[model samples]
Target: MAEELRLFAGVDAGASRTALVLGDATGRILSRVRGGPGILRPGRAGAVAERIAGLLKQALGASGPVASLEALVIGAAGAGREAERGALEEELRRRVESRAVLVTTDAAVALQSAFPEGPGIVLSAGTGSIAIGRNREGTVYRVGGWGRQFGDEGSAYSLARAGLAAVAKAEDGRGPKTLLTARMLEAAGKVSVEELIAWARLARPQRVAALAPVVCRAAAEDPVASLLVQAAAAELAHHVEALRERLSDFAIPVALSGGLLVKGSAVRDALVARLKAAEPPVNLVDRGVDPASGALALALGLRP
Candidate 1:
């Protein structure tokens, strides 16, 4: 007789998208599914929970009914607070049939994905930015992640907003000319700055963040764009510096995650170079692992 297969499910819910992965007992992934935005705020827990549940079901269906998950782990953005995590946890409990379900902040899982055990730091800079570090004593420290309003300085949304601001400044003859003005006009599908401004007024963070690549591309040839990229890198390095201060007084490996850092781009290279040149220098991981995979590892008790 063949050995029975024990399955687990891992969910990585971020501000922009929610990803689900189905894995067997050995942590081998069987299926993956993606859905809409996650619960990044306490107020949207119910809706995000519903979306996650739907994605879970979709993954299960795609993987076939013969496989049943023994556990489900979810790492969600904005689930840092106990109340918000509890609400989502309760909702998952009511929706998923797994025997074990765990909930934590997305940053925690991102850290686990890179470090697995021991001490390390993980900086996630997608639509938003947050840094998390774990000490050898298992103490977790966090910096930034205040969302787009007050924090998220090194985030794609921040980069996009800065790019737009530069364009406005240039249009008013208050700032140096740059290629970003034309890029913004192209992205907004408008012929004039006034129309672009009108569209921008109604653009959400995701829509605005979509322009980060434009800024990055122009950075190679445009001085203003280059400065913005450099400034963004500096902001991200600050987050690492702040988190490093809270950790143990030792060299710890740092991992960069999220679309902005993970993707091959100029900003990533600049950020890495900045960290490498920092006083005492930061030990950055070559690449980041998937947070959903980290959730799977956690579900299988892979941690020390």
Candidate 2:
């Protein structure tokens, strides 16, 4: 009889999408699946769970016998809360016979991925924004995970909000004029600023966030848009500065990630420049590893 292969499953559940990857002990990917957003948000648990189950099945098909699985690691948005993490863990255990399950907030995996072996800061700007890091001596620092309504100061939502506001103010002659009015109008496909307001007011977080790229593209040719991008980058750097103060005693590498940074747009360059402006500048280190890989490392108990 052949021995049953023990596989590790890594899951990253976000507000917009959920990713699942099954891997061997040697970090070889066996199967990967993606599904609708996780049920971390309020009042969407049932639908989210159903979506996640479908994705899990797809991943399991390629992973072989789920009964022989050794460990599962899940990094999810809003999973930082103890109750939330506990609930998801219970659900997973009931669904499968995996020997162990580890659940953490997505930021945890991002941090681990950025600095698997040591101390480093990770700036993630997606639908929202957060800066997280751990020092060599085990001290941790964090900034800006307040969500879209309250914070998300350096996130895509922030950019969209600023762009819309600029156009609105310009239309009313209350702010400086800019080409962004035309650009935003084109991107939103609306007749006027009023229509744009209505369009974004009812749109999902990611939907509003989608305009960030458009904003960046216009910023390249428009000075007003450039100022908005610069401001967003500055805000992100401010968070890094706060972390720096908190970890004053430790030497740490700083990594910029997510759509804004990865895209290499003006916003990202401004963020880098602002960080360097600090009195004691941080070292910009490479976060070569992706979040999915970090989740895998966590599943296999190989994370540093």
Candidate 3:
């Protein structure tokens, strides 16, 4: 009889989506799967768990036989809190049995992706923003990632919120008449400013953050939008600076991740300039780093 394969999985549960990397005990990748947004909502943790479990099952196939994997590691935003992480871990375990389940913060895996072997900073500005890193002595440093309510500064959500505010101020003559008013209105797919307001009032964080690209695209022609993007850049830079100060390595690489930090975008460009102009400057890792791989590494005990 053939030996039952000892399987493992890792998940990156980000605001945009959840990705899983499936592998076996031999350190070979078996499959990669994706699902809808996996960010843990305040009242919707169970749904998220079900969605992730469905993907895991899809990757494993229906007849894979084993009731549980050897291990599963998940990196999810808002999972840093013991209560939240414990809840998510419990939920996953209930749906997909595993010998060992590990839950960690989204930023933790992101930092691992950027610098799997040593100290480096990863600045993530997706629907939310966060910076997490480590120093020479293995001490970790983190900034932001407090969620939208606690100020997801430099995030797509923040920029969109500010852009909406700018549109409101411009409409009332309380601020400059900027193209953001038109740009954001169009992006929201509303025919009128009133419709835009209605949509903004009831939109989810991801929907609101969708307008951030509109803000970014309009920044080239709108002074108000440009200022907002610039401010976001500064805030993101501040995050990196805070962590860099805590890191002992002077030449560590700095990785920019997420939608808002895409190459050549207004915010990314401004942030790169700001970091490059720092007193001692900074090093940037231009390649993309998949945090799911980092999560898998942790799952397989591939790194410390």
Candidate 4:
């Protein structure tokens, strides 16, 4: 008789994109799918759940009908609170045909991806910024990630917002002129400040965060853009420092993940440089693993 096949699925539901991966018990990937964000905002839980369900269905269908998932794990942004995670887990359980379903913050999975089963830290800066660390005893500590209204200082949204503010200041002669003004004008197709302001009022956070690359491109030569990038790095460093303080006094490995930090951007370089020059000196991992892969590892009981 042939051995029975068992499957698992892992979902990384971020603020900008949602990625799902289907794998067998042997740790072989069967299928993968991508979709819009599945991070449940205050009033968008239902819609996000539907989107995630659809992505799962697509992944399973693409893989084959013979396979049945035994477990599914999801690591989602905006699921920091236990209540929020419970709600998302219930919603996903109803949608997926799996025996067990687990949900956790995206940071948790990212940490697992980086360290597998030990003490370490994960610093993520995409649409938002957060630093999460785990001690040898398995206690987790977090910093930043208060949300866009009050926090998210080192994130793409923060960088884009600063870039736009610089454009406004330069237009009003309150700040020095920079290349960001022309870049913003070109990107937004706005002729005047009034037009830009009108568009911004209706723009979503993801749309605004999309401009971070433009700011990064100008940072090498543009003084205003350079300062903004430096500030973002400082904020990220602050989060790391706070997390470090909560952990043991010994140096620990720090993993950098998310778009802003993982990608080849000025902010990434600046943050890395800053961390390296810190008093205690940071041990940053050069490569970052995907959070979805970490979710899969958790589903397979490879890591706690």
For residues 1-304, what per-residue lDDT tens digits would candidate 3 score against the true structure?
A: 2333777788999887899988777657888999988887566668878988998989888436566788888899777678888788888888988888888988888777778776788889999999888876788888888889877899999999999998888888899898988777677778877789888889888999988989898989888988999999999999888778777666778988888998778899989999999878988878577888778877878322
Against the reference, the lDDT scores of all candidates come to 0.85, 0.78, 0.84, 0.84
What TM-score does each of the candidates earn? 0.93, 0.91, 0.94, 0.94
State which candidate has the highest lDDT: 1
TM-score of candidate 2 against the unseen true structure: 0.91
> What value does the lDDT take at residue 302 in candidate 1?
36
Task: Return the candidate ranking by lDDT, descending.
Answer: 1, 4, 3, 2
* lDDT tens per residue, model 4, 51-116: 888988898788667445788888889878888888877777777678888888888888888888
lDDT by residue for model 1 (1-304), tens: 1323577888899877889888887778989999988855767777877887898889888776753568888999877788888888788787778778888989888888898998989999999899999988889999998888899998999999999999999999999988999988998788998888778779878888989989999999999999999999999999999888888634888888888886678789899899999988998776556898888888777321
Off by over 4 Å in 4: 1-4, 66-68, 302-304
Candidate 1 runs further than 4 Å off: 1-5, 66-68, 302-304
Worst 10 residues of 1 by lDDT: 1-10
Off by over 4 Å in 2: 1-4, 302-304
TM-score quality measure for candidate 1: 0.93
lDDT of predicted model 4: 0.84
- Model 3: runs farther than 4 Å from truth? 1-4, 62-67, 302-304
Estimate the overall C-alpha local distance difference test score of candidate 1.
0.85
lDDT of 4 at 136: 86
User: Which consecutive 10 residues in model 2 have the weakest lDDT in total?
Assistant: 39-48
